[model samples]
Target: MIGAGMGAMAAAARLAVAGHRVVVYERTETYGGAVRRFERDGFGFDTGPGLLTLPAVYRDLFVKTGKEPLEDCVELVQVDPCARHVFADGTEVSLPNASRAGVVAALDKALGAGAGERWGAFLVRAREAWDRTRRPLLEEPLWPNWQVLAEKEPYPAVAHRRLLRTRQARTLSEIGSLELRDERLAALLESSALAHGLDPRTVPASAAVLPYMEHAFGTWYVHGGIRELARAVYERCVRRRVEFVFGAEVVRVLEKDGRAAGVELSDGAVAEADHVVADVDPAWLKALTDRPLDGNGDVRADPFMTRPGRFALLLALRGGCEAGAAHRTVVHAPDPESELDFLASADGDQPPPPTVTVLRPDDPALRPDDGHESVVLSAVVPSAADWDEEGMVRQYTEHLLEAAEAVIPGLRDRVLWQEVRTPDDTDDETGAFLGAVPAPALAAGRGRFLHPSNTTRLPGLYRVGGWSHPGGGLPHAGMSGALVAGLIVEGPEFRGSR
Candidate 1:
């Protein structure tokens, strides 16, 4: 495997079981890609994705290894997913899990009857859209590299949904502001847009799948830190006897007879495999390609460029944060005008701190009420290129703390220890180009061609990670990894030389 990111590890585990000799190289001393963690005193914090909703993926992973998921890996308890909106106008409303009825009732009480019905109607449509896009595109890998662009069944509907302007664009107190109105609900909907680094006025409706899926599947937290996912994959690979070459920085991918042969490391060492899979960002993988191939065989990963860097804060706290059965995506978003205004300029390749995600919406274990609440606030910040380490640290620490303090009184003073992970940290640590964390931008304007997808470019090579097709995000990443594995090993007809 190219890089030992989580997706890469998952792919490596599967490929190894399929009887291919697998070797993984990682630049860091540790493995897990974005699944990094930190702790101080009595408190701990997961530096990356904490709210894992899709349990089936993990279940399937363990089953593949002939092990029980809960026994072999971390146990996951379903969280009652709900988004509580604290609008600037000083109104707070919560929309809860699969309880679309409750959401409608709440909206009727807060917004309008018409608005409530509209939301329900849209929820139904969103669910349908999810169903339509689920299998053929979202859960499947682009095979043969030509089917997507060739004379065959292409995913135009799925592509259209991803590329078009989201429902957030037309409504919710922003640009279009179509029919039913409750300014508070409007603000809540708008806040959801910023929650994902998207502009409410521009993000496509498909993005709404997050809320719908959260309600349907239920939000969840791994018993320990979410980083347990990395641990599980690592253990599986080890059991399969996959060799993990830590700190082996690969510099070039060797091509022989016009097919992938092996990789050359920075230390002049070489590791050969039947077929190579890239787990880093596409741009990063491109750098290692001794000579760049067309790389255009699949538009899934290479199609969409990247988004800006994220300004993240991992604070080991001295106190606990409350989380009930349901979770809340806290967005201390400035007013709509300010939020949209900032989003427009965000692409200047400029770093601006506006949105703040206070994630432990639910999960008292991670954030105990008695004490030990790990708070992580990640916002889009200026790239490492824009500022020096000292400057970046100072900015992230001050701005994010101030924002958190407003939500939790005396938060800055309560902080026992702080570790600031700038977008630059993401790049330097994960080799993500432009410091792109998790997934890059699939802007509304560019719409259709976004999302990291497609495993292989042509016949032999495979790609997965922050820059591949189907786009980035924990589920997308995991799904893309499995799809690639399935295509290479279990697909009805592709013979990847092993």
Candidate 2:
């Protein structure tokens, strides 16, 4: 394995159990790729993903690789009122975790009588899309005839008639206008896509599965931090006898008999293996090999070349946790169009206060004592923006703090100190091109949202992680590892996870 990311480690553990000697070479001194923790004076925060959805992905990993279950490895707590949404129009709603009726009632109580019903109706349709594509997109390898997935849009969009003409929502923005109808409801839907660095206006209607999956599986938080989950997986890999070499970067992939046989390290040392699994980004992987990994008809590696990345603020607050505060709160932007325009623009202008997610997990492990708290604020921004400019980063941090104040009143005053993380920081850490975070693969727009196959053209080479099949997100990356292991252990005849 080329990197010790969550996906790579997951694969390492499984491959080790399958009687294959697995070795991971990570350039960083530590493991867990982007899944990292920041600490200061006993206060800690999860700088990567704050919450885990569809945790069954990890649960399955533990069950297959060992006798111990995932719950035994890490404490998983389901977050109640999964999220609190504060819309631009001052409308607020606390959505219940995995309860359709509860969510419907809350929406009705907060956004008027019929709002909840409409959102509920949308979820039913989103579930259809999920069922239609779940196997091909998440469980199975990218099919050779992948164009079938591209030509088919699995989202069952409701039809509307205007001027005696029938039309169905094709994009997420249209679904908001034609079906959702309410601006606040639309914002709620669009924010889910925006959180994943997707533009709802252009993203496929199949993207509705994003919010649906969250609502269905419920949001969960592990004890300590999400980094704890990564630590558990890393420990599991070690227990399985998988070898890890940290700070050992693979400079090039060595080929033997026209197949990927080994990797060359930056120190000019070579390690030979029967197969090579890469968990790095597409651009970085391309630089490692002279061979063409994908043919013309194959799904392109960098589908969304200019996708946005996250800008985060890790705040150490002076106050203790509030008596009744939602664990996660989304503060919507005042002008959604302006924020979207800024993201789409290539001129690198200062962005307006974008929609920000404020996470305040009430875990004792995250803080020094009862008198202090750790809060993380994140927003999606253009990955190629001038994040290197200290002034720009500072200004964006202020914008995020200002937006977070809507959810966390007196936020600035409560902050004892703050740490800022920009796309440039993500680039330095994960080596993603321009720090662009890959969005989950959606099954429309002519496969533009789909990721490349895990099996590359290079015979013994395979791809795993967010940059490969099924695309980004915690669950998807885990599934990528499972698929890669399945392909390697069972050969080309392997179907998928049962």
Candidate 3:
């Protein structure tokens, strides 16, 4: 195995159970890749994703790998009133967890009269897209003739009567405008795509499944933070006797007789193995292989369509969290269009305050004491931003902090210290190019935006991680590991996890 991220660890655990001498070579000294923790002055914050959705992906891994389940390894708490969304029009809605009816009711009450029903009706179509793509996109490996999956838009979009001709909504933005009707409701729908670094204007309607997946599974936080989930997986790998070599950066993949034989490390040490499972990002993987990866024989240099990075503000405040606050609050941008445009632009145009996701886990383990609170403010920005400059980082950090005051009242006054992390930090940590964060795989129409196949061109080599098939996000990354292990253990005929 290569790299000790969640996907690599997951593949290691499963392969270990199958009696493979799994050894993970990570460039960093730690196990988790981008899922890292920062601690200072008795306060801790998760530098990556703070919440987990579609946890069943991990549950299945635990059930299949060992005697104890995932819950036994890490405490999982479902966030009630999953998130609070403050719209541009001063409309605030507290969306409950895993409840469609509750969401509909809340939207209706908060937005307007028929707002809930419109959103509810849109979810029904989203459900169709989910069911249609679930088997092919999630459960099954990318097929040989995968163009069928890409060309077909499974989202049963409502035909809108605009003028003379009735046309079905194609893009996510079109669906939001034609079906959702209201601007605020459209923003609500667009948030799912924007969160994944996808542009609502271009992403196919299949992207609707993104929101459906979250609302269906419910957002959950590990007791300490999301980094704890990585710890649990690493611990499980240790219990199974999977060896981990830290700081062993793989320089090149040694090929023997047209197959991957082993890897040459940065320290000039060669570790030979029968098979090599790569958990690194796409660019890093290509550099190791020194060739285009085999994805139905048409692999591009950069497989990803949209590579957006996160700008995170880790704040240690002096006061405790209020009695009952939503675990996650999205301070929506006043001009959603302009914000999206700025995130889409490569040049550093000061975006009108980007939509910020403020995460404040109620877990006491995160803070020094009840008196202190650990809050994270994260916003999606262009990975091409000049984040290497201190002035740019400082300016954006302050902008996010100011926007966060909408939820965390008097945030500037209460802040004891702040740490800023840019895409450069992500690139340094995970080896991703330009520190670009990969979005979850979306079946963009016209055979566009689909992730590369897990089984690459090189024999005896496999791809497993956010940058591989099924794309980024916790559940997808975990599933990528499962798919890779299944292919190696059960051969190319393997469909997916049963």
Candidate 4:
């Protein structure tokens, strides 16, 4: 395995179970790709994924491996009231976990009773789409022996979607108009789609399934943060005797007669393999292989990857900052046009205004014993087009920090430490292509092609993380690891090897 990211980690565990001698090479002196956490003083914060959804995916992986995903250690609270949404128009909505009625009730209180009823109707339709699609598109591997999933129900039965070519074609305007009379409510529903990183106007309507999953399934936050997931996978790797070579950068793919062999490390060491699975960035593989760039033999051009890396801010605060919260709170533009305009501003002309995402570790322990509240503030800016670690101008850095402190009073004094991480950090840390969140367009449509999955490409090589099929984020990445294991052992390979 190359690049010990999430997919690489998951693939390592699965391959070890298959009785293969697995070796993982990571450039960083750490394990767990995007899901790793950092500890400073007494504060600890998860780097990439914090909110987790799709519990079944994790449960399934543990079952496949003859271990319990949750029984041994860690417990999933199955968080309710998943998130609190604050919009530009002073509209506030709290989304409950895995329950449409609760969200509708909350919407009714915030927007109007009429708006709540409309939301209920849309929920019913979305639920139908969820039942139809989840089994086929999400659960199946991209391999050839794939079975057709989701008995396609009539579109009308699900929702009234017309004149929309792809889900990308249906913008927030259509969702606002068709789904609910309350424009604010519509924005909240579509906001989940933006989590995919495409323009709300261009994202496909078929994505209605996502909000359903979150509300019906509810999002989860792992105890002690998302890093616990990495520990679980790591523990499994240990039991299987997977060898981890951290700080070992792979220099090149050593091809033998155009068949699989192994990799050459940066320090001139070569490790051989009958089947070489690359869990690193796929672009790395494309650069190494002579394969044409237009498309791979089975893979297509990835729309999610065509976007930029996510700009992030990690803040360390005293444990008590929650009481001194700033009133400026936060605001998100309701429509994609505004969001895209904000993104384009940073494309080279000027530093994009740091769109703020607030993170408060509910765990009081995140603060240092020395009176510091450590919070990691994150925002998705136009990925730093020229995010140079060394050459970044002082003015550019000031702009993001000032923007954050402006919204948060006392942020300067409350901070024991503040660091600015551009899209570059994401690349160096997880080796994600372009180092940003994958757009929904990548995981939305037919999904036959391998985007970033462990089961695609080669037999021994498996994929994981946001780039994998079914897209990115906490729950999806963890589930992907399990899915790869299921695809492998469940096959007749178990009998053949035995």
Candidate 5:
């Protein structure tokens, strides 16, 4: 395996248990890839994903790989009032975790009488999309006849008639306008996609599954930080006798008999293996081999090359977290269109204050003491932006701080110090091209949202991680590992996890 990411380590553990000697070569000094923790003084923050949704993916990993369950490895705390949404119109709603009825009631209470029912109705449809594509998109390998997935849009959109014409929502933006009539409700719907670096205006209606998945599974936080979950997985891999070589970068993939047989390290040393599983980004993987690993019909690297990355601010605040505070709060942008327009623009202009997510975990492990708190503020921005420019970073940071103030009372005065993480930082850490974060694969928009198959054209080569089948997100990446392991152990006949 090339890289010790969560997905790669997941595959390593399973492969080792299957009687295959697995070795992971990660360029970084540690594991977990983008799932990293930042520490200053005694304050710590999860710089990657703040919460875990559909944790069953990791739960299954532990159950299959060992006798111990996932709960024994790490404490999974379900966040109540899963999220607090502060909309553009000053409407606020605290959504209950995994409670359809509770969320509906909260929405009705906050956004007016019928808002909750409409949102609830949309989720019912979103669940249909989930059921239709869950197997092909998440549990199974990317089918060879993948075009079938492309041509079919699984979302059962409610139809509307206007001027003797009947129409159904095709894109997420259309779903917002046509179905979710309220602007606040639309913002709530679009924010889910936006969090994945997707443009709701153009993203397929199938993307509704994003919010549906979260609502159904509930949001969870691992104790100590999400990094603790990665640590547990790494420990499991070690227990399974999987070998890890950190700071050992694979410069090239060695081939023999037209198959990937091994990898060449940056130090010119070569390690041979029967199969090579890459956990890096597609673009980085392409650069590792001279052979055309993907054909014309395959999911190409060009489209993902410029995907948006995250800009995060880690704030060390002087005051303790407020009593009964929602763990996660989304502060919507004043002008959602301006933010979307800025993200779509290639000119790299100053972005309008973008929608920002403020995370204030109520865990004691994150802070030095009761007097100090660690807060993470993040927003989605173009990965191609000039993040290295101090002016750009400062301007964006100011915008984020301003937006966060809406949720965090006296946020400016409470901040003791702050660390900025831009796409450039993500690029340096994960080696993702331009620090781009990959969005989860969705079935629709002619399969434009789908990721490449885990099985590459190179016979002994396979892909595992967010960049491959099922695309990015904590759960999807874990599934990619499972699929890769299944394919390797059971051969081409493998039908994925049952």
Candidate 6:
């Protein structure tokens, strides 16, 4: 295996149990690719994902590989009132965890009468889309005739008449405008897509499943920090007898007679293997192979346009967290258009402060003590190159903190010190070009955003990770690991995990 990201480690554990002597060669000195942690004066912060959704992916891994389950390794706590959304219009709503009725009532109470009814109705349609695409998109490998999923929009958009002409919403923006009919409701729906690094305006109606899945499964936070979850997976790999060679940068994937044999390291060391499971991005994988895999029938000609990387602010504050603060709060941009415009821009000036996802976990373990708190503020921004401009990064950091002020009143004053993480950090750490966060695979735009096949054209070579088949995010990456393991162990006949 190459690289020790969550997806790679998950695959490592399973492959080890399957009787393969998995030797993971990660370039970095540590494990957990982007899922890393930062520490300062006893304050700990999860530099990668702040929370976990659809944790069943990890649960299944533990159940299959060991006597202990996931819960025994990591303490999973379901965040109540999953998130607090503060809209530009001063409308605030704290949606409860996995409670449709509760969410409906909250939306109604916050956005006025009937607002929740429309949202509830839309979710029903979104649920249908989830059911239709769930298997093909998540559980199974990409089919040969994937064009069917690409062309089909499973979302059942209601028909509407405008100027005596009938039209049905197709894109996410249209659904927000024609169906939800309220700016706050539309923002709420669009936020889900934005969180995935997708532009809602162009995202297919099938993207409605994004928000539906969140509300159905509920959001969760692990005790200590999300890094603990990664640590647990790493330990599981070790227990299963997977050997990890940290700082062992793989320069080339050695091939013998047109089949993958093993990997050659930067230090001129080579380890032969029966098969190679690459958890790195496609570009990196290609560089290692020194040749392009067969790609005449791939999903897209270019996959780098998926989404931009993250700009984060890890704030170590002087005061404790407020008593009734939600674990996560979204401070919506006053001008959604400007924020979207900035995110879409490649050379444009920093657009208005983008939407901010503020994570203020209440876990005492995150802080030095009760007197201080660790808060992480993140926003989706342009690629790593944009952050290269020190002036631009500083300005963007200020913009993020200013928006965060809405939730953390007197936030600037409370900050004892701040650590900024830009897209560049992600690139240096995970080796994803421009540190772009891969958008989740969707069934629209002819499957343009879908990742490449896990089973590459080169025999004995497979892909597993966010940048591969199932796409980004914790659950999807885990699923990619399961799929790759099944394919390698069971051969081409393996469809996927049953």
Where does model 4 exceed 4 Å of error? 66-68, 143-173, 292-299, 302-305, 319-330, 334-336, 344-348, 351-355, 389-413, 439-462, 486-498
| Backbone clashes under 3 angstroms, per model | 17, 0, 0, 29, 0, 0
Off by over 4 Å in 3: 161-166, 295-306
> Alpha-carbon error at 238 in model 4, in Å?
0.9
| lDDT per residue (tens digit) for residues 106-220 in model 1 | 8777655666676776567557646654554456554344233222211112213555643333222332244234555555555544555555565554455555566577666
Which run of 10 residues does model 5 get worst, by summed lDDT? 297-306
lDDT of 3 by residue, 1-498 (tens): 888988889899999999999999998889887899999999999999999999999999999899999999999999999899998888899999999999999998998889999998988889988988887788778888887877788888465566656667789999988888899888888998888888899889889999999988899999989999999999999989999999889999999999999999988999999999998877778889888776434532364444789999999999999988889998888888888778777655455688889898877999999999999999888888787677778778877888788898778899999999999989889988888877777775765667777888899999888887888899998998899989989999999966
Compose the digit string of candidate 6's lDDT tens values, residues 240-307. Answer: 99999998999999899999999999999989988998988777888898676747756542544546
Model 1 residue 162 lDDT?
Answer: 52
Poorest stretch of ten by lDDT in candidate 4? 146-155
TM agreement with the true structure for every prediction: 0.83, 0.98, 0.97, 0.82, 0.98, 0.97
Deviation of model 1 at 215, angstroms:
2.4
Off by over 4 Å in 2: 161-166, 297-299
- What lDDT does each candidate get? 0.61, 0.91, 0.87, 0.60, 0.91, 0.87
Q: Which whole-number lDDT from 0 to 100 does residue 185 have in model 5?
A: 93
What is candidate 4's TM-score against the reference? 0.82
The TM-score of candidate 1 is 0.83
Please list the residue runs of candidate 5 whose C-alpha ends up more than 4 Å from where it truly belongs after superposition: 161-166, 297-300, 346-348
What is the C-alpha local distance difference test score of candidate 2?
0.91
